[model samples]
Target: MNILIVHAHPEAQSFTTALKSTAQQSFEQQGHQVEISDLYMMKFNPVASQDDFTELNQPEYFNYALEQRNALKQNHLAADIEIEIEKVKRADLVIFTFPLYWTSVPAILKGWIDRVFVSGLFYGGKRFYNHGGMAGKKAMLCFTLGGRDYMFGENSIHGPIEQYLSPIQRGTLAYAGFEVLPPFIAYHVPYISQKDRQDILVDFEKYLKHLDELQPLKFPVLENFDEKMQPLN
Candidate 1:
């Protein structure tokens, strides 16, 4: 399988980077292709604006979605976005590796989503959820957190980790039609011992090796909702 690892950590020696490397090595050992989009290393522009398009449908006023659709049709999307899109398109699976910041993804990763998951290309209208443009692909998140595992449960201070990741898992990945997998999280990496960190890496490699056998997270199918997007009940 072709895998794309979109890495968002700033430091090369960070634990998050090690997770990415582990994934790559594991996949390669299994005879699968791997590609990395090191966002910070590439200095990827996270800000989405009119500059992303070569020719605007309405040059006077800039509407990002409208321009994206226009640019996609004209094959005039920005070089970086186009390149990223191709990477996603060619991949059978896409893994996002990053550090959890403020219960969300980093700004650069968020911006990468904004720019690369373009309208008319990734999703639009009723083409979301199970019917999304990227329906056949798979996506997973591998992230490190500052908080311990117990701090993020239902009765814990941070609520549930699922809640924190719902936006990316359901709204973004699922909406785009990728079969979402359970995330591999490393909690309190900064405070953890080297042995614990190594154990996490070992676990991550095992996860990659068995990715195909893992059951994807269940999501509401488009058929469950009406034209108004209300549950059919």
Candidate 2:
């Protein structure tokens, strides 16, 4: 299978990058073709602007999504976005490797999503969730966090980790029609020992080997919803 790993960490020696490396090695060892998009090393621009398009559909007003649609149709999307989109298209699975920032993805990664997951291509009106343009693809998150596993739960200070991840997992990836998998998280990396980190890497390698067995996370399916997107039940 073709796999794409989008890595988003500034420091190459950081544990986050280590995990990214581990994933790449593991996937390659399994005989799968792997591609890496090192956002920081690539100096990927994270900001959205009029500069993304060669020519504007409506020069008077700025609508990013509409412009994306127009650009896609005209094949006028910026070269960088087109390249990333092609990478996504070629991959059967896309792995996002990053360190959790403010309970969300790093800005660069988010920007990658905003620009690459274009309007007419990745998603559009009534074309989200199971019906999205990327319906056949799979997406998974592999991240490191400073928070301890105990620090999050229904009875804990921060509530469930799933709660913090819902926006990215459910709102974005699943909404874009990726069969979202359970995330592989390296918890409390800042406080963990080197041996512990190494153990996590070993465990992660095993996780990657079992990809076919991992059940995708459940999300809303359009079949159960009416035209207005309300549950038909």
Candidate 3:
């Protein structure tokens, strides 16, 4: 399988970067093709603006999604966006590697999504969830966090980690039609010892080797909803 690993971390020696490297090596050793987009190294622009398009559908009003659709149709997307979009299209699987920032993705990664997951292309109208443009593809998140596992849960201080991830996991990935896999999180990474971190890398390699065995996370099925997207009984 062709895999694209989008890595978003500023520090080269960070644990998150190690995880990204481990994923690439593990996948390649397993006979899969791999590509890495190191956002910080590439100096990826994290802002979505008129600069994203060579031309606009409506120059009078700056509606980002509308312009995205126009750009996709006109082949007018900025070169960087087109490059990332092609990467996404060619991959069978896309892994997002990042250090959790404020319970969310880094700004650069978020911008990558905004620009790459173009409107009218990735999704539009009801072409989402099970019926999104990326239906046959798959996506997974491999992120590192400073929080310990015990610090998150229904009864924990930080509440459920899933809640913090729903926007990206369900809203963005699942909503775009990719079969979203359960995330592999490296928790308390900063506080962990080098041995523990190495062990985590070993565990991660094992996880990558069994990608076929991972079940996708459940989300709203279009079949279960009425024409208006209201749930049907």
Report lDDT (Cα) of residue 206, candidate 3: 94
lDDT of 1 by residue, 185-207 (tens): 99999998999999999888887
Structure candidate 3, residue pairs in collision: none
Can you rank all candidates by lDDT, best first? 2, 3, 1
- The deviation in Å at residue 232 for candidate 3 is 24
- Deviation of model 3 at 178, angstroms: 0.8
TM-score of 2: 0.96
**Runs with alpha carbons beyond 4 Å of true place in candidate 3:** 224-233
Across 119-217, the per-residue lDDT of candidate 3 in tens digits comes to: 887888767889888999999999999999999999999999999999999999999999999999999999889999999999999999888999999
What TM-scores do the predictions have? 0.95, 0.96, 0.95
- Candidate 1: C-alpha lDDT: 0.92
Note the Cα lDDT for every prediction shown.
Answer: 0.92, 0.93, 0.92
RMSD, every candidate, angstroms: 3.3, 3.2, 3.3
